[model samples]
Target: MIATRKLRRARVLIAGCGDVGLRCVPLLAHRAAAPRVIALSSQPARAAELRAAGTTPLIGNLDERRSLRRLAGLASTVLHLAPPQKNGDDDSRTRALIAALSAQRRSVARGATSAVARQRAWRGWFRATFKSSMRAGVKMHAKAIKRPSIVPDRVPGTAARPRQIRLIYASTSGVYGDCGGAWIDETRPVRPDNARAKRRVSAERQLRGATQRGLLSASIVRIPGIYAGNRLPLARLQKGTPALAPAEDVYTNHIHADDLAAILVLAIRRARPQRVVHASDDSDLRMGDYFDLVADAFGLPRAPRVSREQAETQLEPMMLSFMRESRRLQNTRLRDEMRYALRYPSIHDFLRDFLRDFRSEANAQFTITSVPVESPAE
Candidate 1:
């Protein structure tokens, strides 16, 4: 059985409380210890919902040093889920947070005149340190940041933690490039053939660097196509988005967002090593076949097909590239190491559940529409 003691009721700091982070909240909330979840988002509406869900949601910029200090002080483990920054802004934010936390520690370590005075002094120092960090963070994250080739230098005046905090950085499978129908596992060498894939490879290196330096207990989770409920591709087809079958036999993987979140939480609880974990359901369904399944689920027509030559010419460069890659991602590590089993293991299961919910919602809408109008007659 998966041990829950380490994570139960543990204070958690979640940055970028968007779709994934929000989904993780309810799962963590239901744990035995019922953790004191602290969510940080720049959006007010999102922060409000987090608050409603019994989590302490802070609405502020993550780039601010003060916010980082306050958050670091409150939680031992931090989940960084900010959008992928293409200009190294993410690195700056990480640097700032570490620096601010380091400063707070130094201030605390400085000798205090008296026990009571020291307590007061420490509190005052924390407030001032947080304020300064927040100011710096705001400037650093003001724009879209790109991933750098090498890990950036640590911020000055910040001390490294005796034992670094744990972090899980969400990544993408696009880093694998076109595997050409081969099976890929963690041990497979990365051969990124495109600009986007190259960038992801570089970003993964930076994450590994943090681990090597003993600055962070970091791991990378490479997620494939993720879908759930209304977010599934079938829903898009039902809503009349054009579904076309690619001419090439490109194989891809997918996982439910809920499952992905669960795996992450489980990994954290297990303190599973600083390593890479693929968050795919282990499905190697072809793109064309997958589309056919979606169509069947939604009772829509089979997607129109195009010749290989036509597909190459008609599709966008990015879309065409995706259809050309054919790789079966191995999930044996997740199964054996993490001992994690997917909740939705195949496209069939995903479509079945997704369609059931879709039909129920559609039926309710139809019933509301068909309700008889009460006449105001006599």
Candidate 2:
């Protein structure tokens, strides 16, 4: 009975409940008639935090299909925030998830059909046999309640009206690979240069394939560099790392973490089915310019600029990999399809607001000291 009751209420399943997923929980939970929210967490320690965030924590790993069985036919909507498994070119986890949802959808269709047919037959018999008697009883109850009451409405969907599950996948903008400072849109062909970007491409392909198969209405939000006050590259800047010269540098993109979270929610609620949109802010600064801006804002010396040849030897390979990609994402589709206006429209705006509080805290720490006060009447 409890399971039946749970099934009747709308539920949203978050397959990956990390930083952004945690943010999305409250967005759904605080609605007027909120749906039940569930989050899958690999670590049992986070169960309490997930619960506190108003989500029922499902302890499961995306890699283990057996662990995910509880999620089948469970939610009307799913937010697949999990990334592709490490050490793989293809995403087997996504494949498993799609299969599970497909199986459950089919099962629900059959069950709903059977249940609806049985309900109609039972209703017909009850009306024919107990019409007069039920009328009198209903009249008496109406008098007491001051209004006539009929049987409660049936559960929302039937076989004829199967629920359509929707998915919003977060992808990486690296799929466009080294655009040579051109403006790339969703229609741009993906040219992933590394294994990491390849893996993201594979995940996007799987979701797109699922959409084509009519298993789910899916939207892909290809994100670029995500930054916020807490997630900035302050540590790298403080390390005195050198950036590529402007002539050799790549044009980079950025979206504040909060704006990315908002876009994810919007994609789930408003994005067109099978659509791909860039979730980037209006900042179109070069790699060195971005570092310089942040350094200037934080009152740190700007990183020295090095030629491409010198940077290869001086910078770490991971940093070099980022410097190789150059593209400004066109966010027309995001605005048109998702109807989203980014809260942090650019890096300068976000940093200015963040540094205001950051500088205050820094100043307070520098001036304040803890000292023991003597007890007057010990």
- In Å, residue 207's CA in model 1 sits off its true spot by 2.4
lDDT of 1 by residue, 1-378 (tens): 246664444687777676677788888777877667788777777756888866798766656666555654556566666644345323454455445434544443344323454555545655566667677774333233433343322222333333356777666677777878788897777776665556556656766776665455677777777666545444334444332455456777777778988877776766354688887886768777776786787577765677666677665566666665678888887898888878899878877776677677755532111100100000
lDDT of 2 by residue, 56-96 (tens): 99998878888888877778788888877777688787888
lDDT of each: 0.63, 0.76
Tell me the TM-score of each prediction against the true structure: 0.71, 0.80
* Clash totals for all candidate models: 16, 0
Tell me, what's the RMSD of every candidate? 14.9, 11.1
lDDT of 2: 0.76
